[model samples]
Target: MRFEIMNAGKIQLCASLCMWLGIVTWTGNMKLHIWSVFVQQSYEGDVVFSVLNEQVNVSKGLRDGKTFSIRSPVTRKNAIEHRVFWSAWLDSLSTRVFGVEHERAWRKQVRDARVVVLEAGCGRPTNRLATFSDGTRACVRYGIDADQVLGETLSYYLAELLGISNLPPLALSKLNLSSEQWASVRGHIEALEWSPNAIVSLTEFIPNVTGVFIPLHLRKQQGGLQLSPETVSNMTVTYLVELMQWSDLIIFDYLTANFDRIVSHIFSLQWDARVMERTTNNLLKTINGHLLFIDNEAGIVHGYRVLDLWERYHRLLLGSSCIFRRSTVRRISEMKRSGDSAKLLCELYRAREPLARELGSLSQEHALTLQNRIDVVYKHIQQCTDIM
Candidate 1:
């Protein structure tokens, strides 16, 4: 229940609450500055954005079709430290300091917001620019498949269930789009919609992010560029090594049988060295690179199609070797040894039980399936741990 708020070039990183005029909190892992806790109502339930009652000009973050470049240099020392920091954070997830309860509260605060659709991007599932009612802007994806969206939601729950940070806060809400907005998205849609309100999943977009250094499979999909595994690994290891998130993400994908995670979907945040120097923030200054997982709508399909898809991508997870850190395995081992793994699973089951009643049919069945898969995943973890 703690957040470090940055304002007017000053940062306060403590758990204690203080009263300040027009305060806004950083809403994502990027730690980029944005609006804080101002509540309002929209067509959706509750919209919380940063600007409260004041008018401020905040950048919507590269919406003008500019190419974001990754110019920040990554050294060996920084990469190792980044790996260590992230792995340690993953290990801390199941503890009292960062458990499911905290995850729920934090997620709710970040996910519920009223957003306006900006520019729409290409793909089967589309990307859009959206601004919160409080004027904080982000990129979003509308859920094309109800089952997939439910699975994505459950994945967040699973991340909470495992006490790890996977995807950023994904808000499930209705959005108001103008006629222009409707026209912009018409090519991507299957049916007609005169109605201005549409239910969408809004993922908190990170500002100043450059495209990630994708894996070979993703590169092939993009344009069929082939590079040796060593060359690719060497390039990626400059900015990422021992990526604990990859381990957890792959485990999640396996549990859900998701296969859409191509390398191009990962994002890398940009660091302004000049800004870092001015702020004198040690954390930001020391580790200038971070990776994020996005586009999680391909999981938990309702039919046999997922089986075909899973077969295609399962090797990425259970591969003989990759850049993923074995931190997830170690964490699982620690949890089982401390008698918390089973307890944690019970907590997840209880948390998901009501959803089984609320969502009904496919989701309800999938909820039960999810719990069963948790058992399978535990066994998988045991196998990995034994080998390790």
Candidate 2:
């Protein structure tokens, strides 16, 4: 029995020691500066983000009536890469990736993307964003741009893309209240407390919104709007500030020919080994003691090592055992078409989401949420069971 247990620990240790700080090292030809060398092989437990308290707010100096702080855990400095001239290039790539019949293909893709987006735009080639986001099964999209969409044909495309009938509530229910959903919710929430979005690993999320989103200020430059990419990006920030409140993050097109706006953030994604090493060195000074090193970037959380010491401390202190937690995926299996009615599905989802929150949280409000979730789930179960 002891041998079996020890063997299990060794296996767990192996997974935790895998290469995580890595980009898809498919081949040297596709290599884009191999800087994400600190990859984690696997991570134990859910690499989570628990707010210490809702009352505690970091006063990171306010700018323009808004303040910023690193609300999630820091996984900075995995070797980053950039692709310049990406707008035009991405258009072709997306066309190939998503296929010409974008409606059918893209709709299906969104049901499985890391982030889903519903955008309204005509100027920017929409599918570039769509194709890139489609690689993951954790996304859905809806677009109302008259030109970009092909009418009810497009509406149907959106309906299918979101994986539901043409109903707002049904589609809305599919959203996991994560970052992508919060973008939509922020548009509605008046008070605008912390974005009620769930935690996410270091996966880069960039939503697709259309409208040329360029600057009217640069409409009639004497040089025929020959602006640098960086300037263009700066302009986009100003434009975004008007159109959407503030996204958790923004991703710019990797326009290679135009190198103006592809700044440090872009450079980070572009995979600079030197920069990555420097960033890793700095983190060692900060969080290395708490989090053990794990696979770097190939899977979920990007930078930061999986701190085993802290994991052991918490597991013992909290008396919770990690079961298949090191797999490093925040996945939701697609609802099987078991002839289950959409209404029931929505109800079931609504009932359990609060329970998920209650289970996932580890804050001071845990007790209050626990009671509320119990009440909500109990009532929901009772209703369905009584009907049955």
Which candidate number maximizes TM-score?
1
Model 2 C-alpha lDDT per residue in residues 234-270, reported as the tens digit of each score = 3322232221110100110010011111123223534
Tens digits of per-residue lDDT for model 1 on 1-388?
2333444533332211111111233322223233333322334433222231222222222111211212222222323222222333222222222234544654464455444435554233355666655665555555554555555555555555554554555545443344433344443343433223555555555555444433334323232222222333334322233233444555666655565553112211133322212211100111123445455566554322456434544544433222233455455445545443434544554454433333322344554554555555556545443443
**What overall lDDT, based on C-alpha atoms, would model 1 receive against the true structure?**
0.40
Model 2, position 358, has a per-residue lDDT of 26
> In order, what is each prediction's RMSD in angstroms?
15.5, 26.3
- Predictions in order: lDDT: 0.40, 0.22
RMSD over all Cα atoms, model 2: 26.3
Q: Report the error of model 2 at residue 181, Å.
A: 18
